[model samples]
Target chain A: MIRLGRKHLFEDLPRFFASLGGIVFAVQLVVVQLGIFFGFVHSSSLLIQESRADFWAAAKEMQYLEITLPVPYSWIAKARAVTGVAEVQPIIIRSIVFENSNGALDYGRVVGFDPAGSLVHLDDHPVGDLREIAKPGAFAADAGQLSSLGVSGIGAEGTIRTKKAHLVALVHDTQPIISPTFLYTSLRNAVLWSPAMIDEFVRDPFTSSFDINSPLNFVLVKAKPGVDLVALRGALERALPNSRVLTKAEMIDVTQRFWVKRTNVGFILGLCAALGILVGMVVVAQILYTSVNEHIREYGTLKALGIPDRLLYASIIWQAVVMGLIGFIPGLLLGLAVAGYAQNARGIAIEITLPITLEVLGLSIAMCVVAAVFAVRRAMTIDPMIVFKA
Target chain B: MNEPRAVIGDSIVMTYPSAAGPVHVLRGANIHADRGEIVLVDGPSGSGKTTLLSILGGILTPASGRVTIEGTDVTRMPRRERACLRLARLGFVFQGFNLLRALTARENIELPLQALGIRRAERLKMIDALLERLGLADKGARRPAQLSGGEQQRVAIARALAGGPVVVLADEPTASLDRENGAEVMKLLCELARERETSVLIASHDQRIAPFADRIVSLVDGRC
Candidate 1:
């Protein structure tokens, strides 16, 4: 049956490809939209998803990683007392404005932590000169946002919240999805720039003081090996009444859900992906039905040859499948290429994972199958006796 | 010598729903064809010759009557069974030659064998032999549209007889051919009927091929 259908396509090459063109475009639509959707899901919670912490402690009522309020710096010690707790790294998160060379201000999130023991990465490299921030004018920020984050250049001096700051080193792959830029420096420099956090008793970066009452934004924690995170979460929740406790996985999920519900990125991309599939299905069906309609006499000839409806249906389906399979090859390659371009040009990371590959292939074939249904009806309804007429 | 009847029909009746009412196309039509015989049925337009051929070929079911091929009463069978009977025992050549325009002459001839699920190598051999026998050996790779009308009819005849059916049903088998081409097609049909003992029933408006037929049945106003 497939052989017959293929032969037919060769005889009517122009019409066959005209039909194939619609399905190919459909494949591209489904692939590109699905790729964009994956990008949105990943970038929404990148910080939480990339961290090495087993558990996270943030201010009570905090719904996301990027929008944290300060909690008592002493909450780290209180959390460490829990049975499964092994280590805690106190951190501060604050929104600050960077003064561009022109003195124009650009807003970004600033993160401060003990550089020697921080779990979050600065472009997958260890922070150089961990003690440099104690100089009162030194800090490191992602370089990808030189324009967006309002940084002048590498080794350029700048100010954050009226405090002198230096861009000692630039980082990569650390651009926060929600904020235009990110700053990572020693806890002392981050405090000087964040006056609100300073008033709330931030831990002094220079003094090795565990008793400092600074208001830290978060605590990154590691459970003892063999400890269940759920149990550890319950323990931390009980120990620190003023903070929210969550496992790293749960925090990632929470952050993603918040962004999806609170922002329109997820819903918009999701709707587009669904629309792509629906449009692809309709376009392919139209192409197939039109081809069948044009070849009614050819189908009638097959019927007169004693070919049953089942084989006829199989032939039509096989024709669609051939077109779909050919179209998907380019669609997948071009879609991934576009995703790569978008990531480079606009800083959006679109990932094509194993499940998505299988899903889109299945979707391509399924749409072709669905498209053949209209043709099947026309083929079966053809009267074989039409060939007997003049 | 009298040969055994390969096809038989008795009192066949057919009616179609029209804008006005049911129009009876075949009423009390009877036809028969013996082994090694070429039967011709000629009539004017709307004489129901084509409808009678469609019924005897087992494609169109009659309102009432029996159509028997090789002693099996196909009208009593279900649709699938009747189709199976057609696939294995009957062949048809239509007015337009009815070759699949997509396939070459050889591929068209192999179509019926393909329906029977014949092996590829075997089908090719059968196609090759038939194309040679029909004087189209060199034209096997040409599509129906690429061939002349006479060549196209020969290809259709090759396709119909490729499976060695019990009988061949043709409707206006030479209507579109030139006088020379029409005579060639008639000669081939007669030779195939006699040499293979395959019966042939033709419904046509052209009387030029009548001298080749072993029997003639006239149909007028849906009765024969």
Candidate 2:
């Protein structure tokens, strides 16, 4: 009733600040970890999420967008014949080695799609013309990848697997976490000049093993209006028995799962966030417990004087809530600053949206209140009789 | 008519089980105080002076005894009900002047009144009057650490009397003070208890202030 909780907490300035520091550390850790988790999940599935296709038909073993085995290009005919399917386009994504004019070599993934197909869409964060990559030996890369891909700007000359290549257009926000960089080009150039396929062609020159017309990573399918995409996907899966037919949402889900569930990065970051909560709880509980111990005599006096146990416990809980609210602000601000740094300097995504901010604030307070439980238990056990002892 | 009995502890027995078996701290001790009377409990160390006071205040339940304050049997009542009765009709003073260190003198005095569910305006009015009457009006803004021993004890007295309780319990209220301060605290306490018609029960071994008591009960070997 007298704000005894806050008064008690602020009575010792050093310990109060120490308690605040713990909450701040916890809030920042949770915010940053969750932010990065959301960011990475978004980045990992950027290709599938941004594509303008109703469904994707990939090799049966494909688990994510980045790691697709080649499906037969001939399967394009079978997919287009499925009912409710309007169009089908074949695409290739393969790792390539690039050599710049200065002979600087770097590795990248090449995404080769036909311009006539409506599968690859970058309308949200608009980029340069897709038609530019249709030219022979021309490719498109995000501007952020210039240094990593060993290329300059547009019109920069480079070699892809010992063949001449040019940087024709620039895109934005299409960076992939699973691959170093994505170089968009025509299917003919990617199939002909991808290093892995070129090695096979050189090793078996007389065989048809390296035929360019047979290798395509995925077949993008478009559905007619009023078509239930789920039924169409089932039809495609049945017709193309060696392929996996997935709706656009399913593609995003698989990609996110591959990184979040199957990869160690997600687990370690998640563990760090949980540890932050634990550290916060420990710090706050220790501080509250110590404060109670120090003020045990006063508490006993109050109890002996007939103070209600409810009011006594409420004071401790109030201290925790105050600490949480006061400590969370700076931590959230610090998290936002770090997110900005990650996004700008390193091209890493760390999104701190409104929902994330609210969620973190709630978590901050919840952890502090939970921490107060320990102190409250200790306070409840104090014997009022002790105050009567001289 | 004789002054109404304000507090009574009937055959109170308190025991503790140790490695040596039951240690009887208070063995069937009986005590009572009338309204507006100042009663002193004097005994040697470990002779159950504090134990008698604790049972009278309902702080420690005797092994087999009845404690009554203001005509209510505190030992038989539920804990919460007993606590409510204690808040409304009884008060306690400890040896160390155990005021909450974080609160100012006025806030410390206001705590029990607040627990009694007194409104803020009424509580403030009562606290001001208590502070003024106890000679601590000007010093109510200071914390316990900032006050002298005598001043801290005066604040504790002000806190005890703020609720206008029917009975006040003091356990060695002057044990931590010097001779002059202890004498001064006893005089102020007895005067306030008389003026408020509050029964004052003090447990102390200080013989110098025995003159202030209306009656003195001495304990020896856990008996009175």
Candidate 3:
């Protein structure tokens, strides 16, 4: 049966492959949609990678980074006091109107960090020195903001009008999470620009002073080697009753779950992908079943020549498997191509990695085998005696 | 004549289920043939001539009685075992040539040998010899769609002989060919039967092939 299976594929592969265009297209749609959905999920967690912090401490019940409550800046000092604490950086986050030179206005995040903070500068490439950011009226614009705001060159000057800060450096990292029209300034400069922020928190003694209009959102923490992360997290959670402590990996997962799993967008896209795969399976089954019926006499003739039903059944399955493989190669390649084009056109981060591509290929082959089983059963049950009847 | 290489059935009776009732297609049909002998089965339509041939060839099982080929009781064997016997010891030339449309002449001839599990080198050798014997060496690479009707029939004969079976059952083998091509095909069947000492049983209504058979069994109303 295996030998016959091989011959069957070798003899009929060209015709089989030529007839599978519809199935391939259908499968490709499912795979590409799934890829883009995964891409969106990755985009929502891009901040975790860009921040490069070992751990994050935020207010308890934080659902998303953008919406989480600010913890006290004093927590930075307390966290740094821990035995294995390598560094502690405070990050203040607030949204403001971004005005382009042409008078077009957009909303973007304004981030305030200490000049020497590790959270503000990426470890791989430091865009601006701590001394540069500490200089009065100095601020840096992320590359994504420079293009969106129509500002050009490294010394491009732009204003964070609401905070009255001047953009001095154009930091080049096209990462959308960090660079999408964000204003980066030193913590002192931020307070100087908006002096009312200091008094507004100081007057409210009952409320935490850090809980002002422009409050601290996160305190990025780096831990030394051999420190038990779980133990550290438990200790921090006890000390800061109003805050939630999470390792970097946990924070990334929370971000993904918040923006992707909990959102309706993932559901809609995932449903469409599943429907596409179902359609592809139906198309393949129908075509293989019809081909089997059309070639009944041939099957009977083979049977009459002493070929067992098992061999005949294998031939039909081999044909289907060959069709699937033929369709899958092109479909897999085209799906990735479409994903790449969509990512470029929409400027949305869609991850289409090698592992995902291989997974889709394996999935497509399994679907083909399942469909072939249905068609082959129909072929095998045909009585050999039919060939001799008149 | 040599010893009877093919044994006739012993009071074979076959009944088929019909919408109206049970329909008996063959009733006590008997046939016999010696080595290198050609036996012609002739009857009108629905007279069970083809049915008798099918039963004798181990393709259709009888409700009662028995069929023996070279002393093997094919009627008593299991379906798959009987099919294996048919493949190993019997050959069939179907009415319509029944050639696989996608395969070329040589590939079609090589099919039976492939079923017999012959090695590739040996199967190709037999296929080449058979095609050359049938004067179809030039047409070996052409598909059935590319060949003439007579050529297709010849390929069917080549397929039957490829496995070197002891007996050949030809059902209206030349029904679609012109007189000249028909005669040529008949001559090839007779020649192969004589040279290889293979028993030949041909079921046909064509009187033209009557003179070529060594014995003629006439059937009527499902009786012989």
Candidate 4:
């Protein structure tokens, strides 16, 4: 038979495009909002996601990576003693303020780990020797934050916690979300710079005397090849009861959840995405409802000809699907453009991956399908005999 | 010999609820048409001509009456079955032509045939013949707006007959046309109905259609 729904949708060009515009607007809004939300989640958990460690042992009740209480440095040997444990390395995380030569100060995190023993993966964007971070006062900073930190390049000097700090390498893609700028260095420098470590021990920057007894943030653990991580995690957890032993995946999940569930920014972005879907739904529903009323008389004629109500409903739904598929193309394209601008200019990473693209498309189609209900109900109730009236 | 009764509506009564009260449109209307017969229902405005036709076509339920089409009682049939019966056995032509503006002439003629699950090859063959018979051969691709009023009516007639229904009901089929076009439509409709051995019912106040009817039944004061 004739494609009644498609024909009806296109019969009035202005109205048809108006409906499409509504769908496009909805798809665009959803794509951008959710895209940014995912970006935020990833950035907040970047270090954990990039870790090569099989498990992460942190202080008990550690909800966030940076805000955790210090894990006992004694956990290193305890974790190494567990079955299936290949190695353990202590890592320190402390928030510190740094000053440029002009006295402008900004905040940054000190991420210090034992380079020889740590299981953490080397960052792909760093442009210098990783081993050099073991040198006294040596650090790496993201190039993106150099101007804000009042540093020029690899050889620039800055002060952290009243101690002279030298930038030994330049890194990229370290744009921070919840945490501030990152300063990557050796564990000795981080320990000397930490206020807690310095207050507990006599200030001795030259001696560089820190041992396994020092309080640290986390311990990265590596499992023997082919070892069951679940079993290893249980052993480690039991061995270090004061620390939480989590698999790599579990640690990433916990960090992402902490940022998304506990922060106002995440909640606001989520609400904005929901509102976009709602707006799109209303737009499609109103457009379809109006289109149905405009063609009410034709529907009556079809009904009089004994066309099944189900077929009529199918026609209306077909129109909605067509609108969704057609509108999503432009919406996605626009969203990608906006995402790029946000990442480059605003420093807000919006990663619109293939999976995210498919998800948004599915949402777009579902929104249209739900919106078709009103139009279908109206079409079904039309009186067929009205065609008989003069 | 008496021809078989293709359609019958007896003592059909219809009422509509109004703010004032329940306004009765038809009371005890009775009508019948045999196979291959042309029946004209004549009446002034509000004389229940449309109401009687509505009842006979199973579009409206009568307060009290029985209707049978080719020996099948449709009055008590469920709405879905009544719709199926209409699709299989009845056709309607309206004053406004009632053609979907989005479809071409040929597609409109294919509506009922498609509804009946006819194959595409057979539908094309049938539509080609119908278009030729109705003098719409060259205009099959033109939408309703592109066709003139008379051509649109011819397409409507072709649509009604495409499924080879047993009964064809025309309600003011020519009311939108001029006198010349109206007469031509009536002549073609009556000829086609007779040639197919189908019953034709025309409900209208137009006097020009009287001469072509095999029988005329006057509906007045809610009775026929």
Candidate 5:
């Protein structure tokens, strides 16, 4: 039976390929749309992965890194006193508008960290020199920002008049460090340039928000080896009632849920993919239906010769499956090519996992089976006596 | 005539229900064919010759009466059962030379064997022998579209006989061919029946084939 199925498939190879052209085109549309959605979700989480932090302590109800408030700068000293805590650092984060070479304004994140502290400078990538940022008005920018600024190396100078700062070293492709256009500067410069910075360190007389003395948006905490994260989380949650301390995994989940899950992007992309599958299925069903109709007399003849309805049904299904595989292979390859092109041209990362590829192929084949089954209803109803009448 | 392999119908009455009313296609039609005999059913168009042949071949069920093939009552069986019996014991050649357009001559002949679950090697050997015998050995690889009317008929006949069925029914097998091609096809049908000892039944108005039959059954106004 398998051999017969193969023979029928091979014999009708031209028809199968012609029909598959539609299926492949449909599948590619769905895959590429889904890939774009995935790329967006992945980009949102890029910073969290690059941070390489064990835990983040943020004010209650922090949705993403950019939206959170800073804890008191002195909290670093108090946190260091806690047992099992390796180090503590204070950092300032703000979003500001900067002018491009074309005089167009673009929004970006500005990060201020202490040059000498282990907590502020956590990246493993080599920074030219610590003293460079120590100079007044000096700042560092990510490669994306540098490119957008139409500048060449770390020595290129650019100004953020909104923050009254000057760029010094340019960090290339440091994604999570600053998502949009991150500019790094010294803590002293951060405090001096921005009007939003509070001078008192203890309290803010104007705002009634959480403790004003808190100097960092999050205090990254690393536990000693062999320590249970669950147990430590429990202890920390109890100790710090004013803030939330979450493990790396928990933070990732929170970020994903808050950002990716709530966004309409995934839903829209998924709907597009579903529509593509539906179109492919319809195309297959119509092609099979027409093919069966065209061979009605042949079917009658076979039936008159003692062939059972079950075998007849099997033959029709076999043809469909063959067409599906033929269509799917090229569809899958074309989908990958489209995704690769999109990623290169638009700077979008589309990750093609093995399981995902297999799943797509399986889905395509299943669609073919469904289409074939639709045609089987007509094939099985053909009367063998039609041959005798003819 | 040799021993009878088919007792076609006993007082068979077939009525088709159309929008107008019940139209009787066959009335008390009886046909019998002995082994190795060529039974030519002669009738004008719409004279119920095809209907009687259909019932005899187990391809149709009469409103009343029964058709027995090789001692099995097919008309009394369910439609699926009748179909299976027809496929196993009877083969048909239609007027259109109904070879599958997508299949080659060899593949068309192999269709019935495939349905019977015959192995590829065995079916190929049988197809080769049948093609050689029909003088179509060089044409087996050609699709029906690539063959002439006479060649297509021969391929259809080869397909019908490939399974070595007990009985073969042909409906106007020479209707689409010229006189010369028609004679050739009739000769092949007669030769196949004699060589294989199978009952051959042909329903046609062509007088050229009448001489090849061992018996002639004349059908008129739904009666034979």
Candidate 6:
């Protein structure tokens, strides 16, 4: 039965190729889309992920990892005084505009950290250093952004919110979410550059609202050993009425939900993947229908010869499965290779693990089975008595 | 001596339902063929010649009357049982040569054996013998497209009888062939029936087919 089924499947090489083509296209679309979706989800929370803080304290509505308002910088001292708080670090994350080489306006997230604090992304110094960044109007920039920042080298200058910011040193792999142009500077200079927050005391010009010592954007907290981070979080939340300290998992969840579940990215990618599968299914079903129509007479002959419906059914299903497997191998490999390129150049992570490979393989087989059902229905209902007619 | 009847269609009445109305194709048609006998149902087009054969082969059920093959009544049986009877005991040759185009002559002949779950070695042996008997010994590997009309008919004949069925039904088997090929196919079927003691029931309007039949029953308006 298998032998006969295979011969019949290959009877029309074009139909066979068409079936395989549809499945391959579907698999590639699903794999690449899933990869890009995951990549976007990963980069969304990269800042919080890279930070060494066990708990992060932020303003009440700082649900998003990228944008946040400031809590008073003095909160760092108060948080350190808490029983289980090992250390507290002050940092400011704000959106600042920049001027490129051609004076074209570009904007990005500018981060300000306490110069003595330890939280930079460099190799030798696991924590970080702000010695060069502490210098007046100087900040460290990721070397990869030299061209984006319109700087020739160290000591080159760029305008951060119209303030003179000299690039003192370059760092590696500092791609922050929300904006690609990231600039790192000392807390004092960051406050100097950060626009002063406005208070409702706006009606009084004598009591100006432009205060450099107003607040800090983020307070990074490290918990002491033998202390439950969850309890410390509760304590910090209680100590600060309108603020929250989020854990790593909580932050990741918040970011993932923001992009995948709560946003349109997940819906759009899901629809594309489904469309790919749907296209493959429709192609296979249409092709199988043609194949069945072409061989309707043969099927009638088989029926008249006492061939059972089960054998006829088995033959069609086997053809579909064979085509699916054949298409899957090449499509999966090709899609993975393309995804690998996106991962490196576009930062889209298509981590095709072993389990994922097996899963997609299963999906391909199931896709063919479902496609075969369409042909099977037609085959089962074929009038075997057609052979009796002239 | 009373010879065993291989197929008996007694007062068969069948009507087909259509959008316009019920089509009265067969009305009280009676037919029978003895074992080792070659019977021909001669009729004009639309004379229920094909419909009567379909009843005997269990392809269609009659509205009235019964069809029995080798003592098994197929009229009251379910569709699946009737189909099983057709598979295990009946073979057919159609006008179109209906040889699975994807399969070679040998493979086509081996189809019934495959359906019956015959062992591969036995199936091959039966296919080889049938091919040799049909005078297609050297052309067993050729598909129907590659075979001449005469050769294709012979392959179709071999496929019909390969399962050693109790009866072989052929409908306008020679209609697609030249006169010479038609005569040869009829004569071959007659000879094989005599040798195997298998009953053969054929429907045809071609005069060339009559000479090869042991008996010819004329069907007019579904009456024999």
Best by DockQ: 4
DockQ for candidate 3, C-alpha atoms = 0.33
lDDT for each candidate structure: 0.79, 0.85, 0.74, 0.85, 0.73, 0.79
User: What is the docking quality class of candidate 3?
Assistant: acceptable
Off by over 4 Å in 6: A18-24, A72-91, A114-156, A167-180, A199-215, A222-243, A333-374, B1-5, B16-23, B34-36, B178-197, B207-214
The segments of candidate 4 whose C-alpha lies over 4 angstroms from its true place after superposition are A147-152, A197-213, B1-4
Tens-place lDDT digits, model 5, residues B152-202: 999999988988888898889999999999999999988987899888889
Q: How well is candidate 1 docked (DockQ)?
A: 0.57
CAPRI class of candidate 1: medium
Model 5 per-residue lDDT at B96: 86
lDDT per residue, candidate 3, A20-71, as tens digits?
6756776688678777777767766655767757888887757876666556
RMSD (CA, Å), each prediction = 4.3, 4.1, 4.9, 3.7, 4.5, 4.8
Q: What is the C-alpha lDDT profile of model 6 across B132-176, one tens digit per residue?
A: 877889999998899998899899899888888889999999999
- Which candidate has the highest lDDT of all? 2
lDDT of 4 by residue, B149-193 (tens): 999999999999889989999999889999999999999999999
DockQ-superior candidate, 1 or 5: 1
Q: What tens-digit string does per-residue lDDT give for candidate 6 at A1-390?
A: 677779978878987887889999988887777766765677676666777788778777775666566676456777888899887887777677877546766676677886676643332432234478888788877655666676677777667766787777776555533356777788778877775466411121224343344547778888888898878998888776578678767876776677776678878988998899999888888887788878888887777777888888899888888878898898798889898786566544565766667777888888888988988899888898888665
**Could you give the DockQ of candidate 2?**
0.68
Clashing pairs in 6: A306-B87
Clashing pairs in 3: none
Per residue, candidate 5 scores C-alpha lDDT tens digits across A63-111 of 7767776565544555565666665555577766666445666566767
What are the chain A TM-scores for all the models, listed individually?
0.86, 0.90, 0.80, 0.89, 0.81, 0.83
TM-score per prediction, in order, is 0.89, 0.89, 0.81, 0.93, 0.84, 0.83
Worst 10 residues of 5 chain A by lDDT: A200-209
Residue A99's lDDT within candidate 2 is: 87
Using TM-score, rank the candidates from best to worst.
Answer: 4, 2, 1, 5, 6, 3
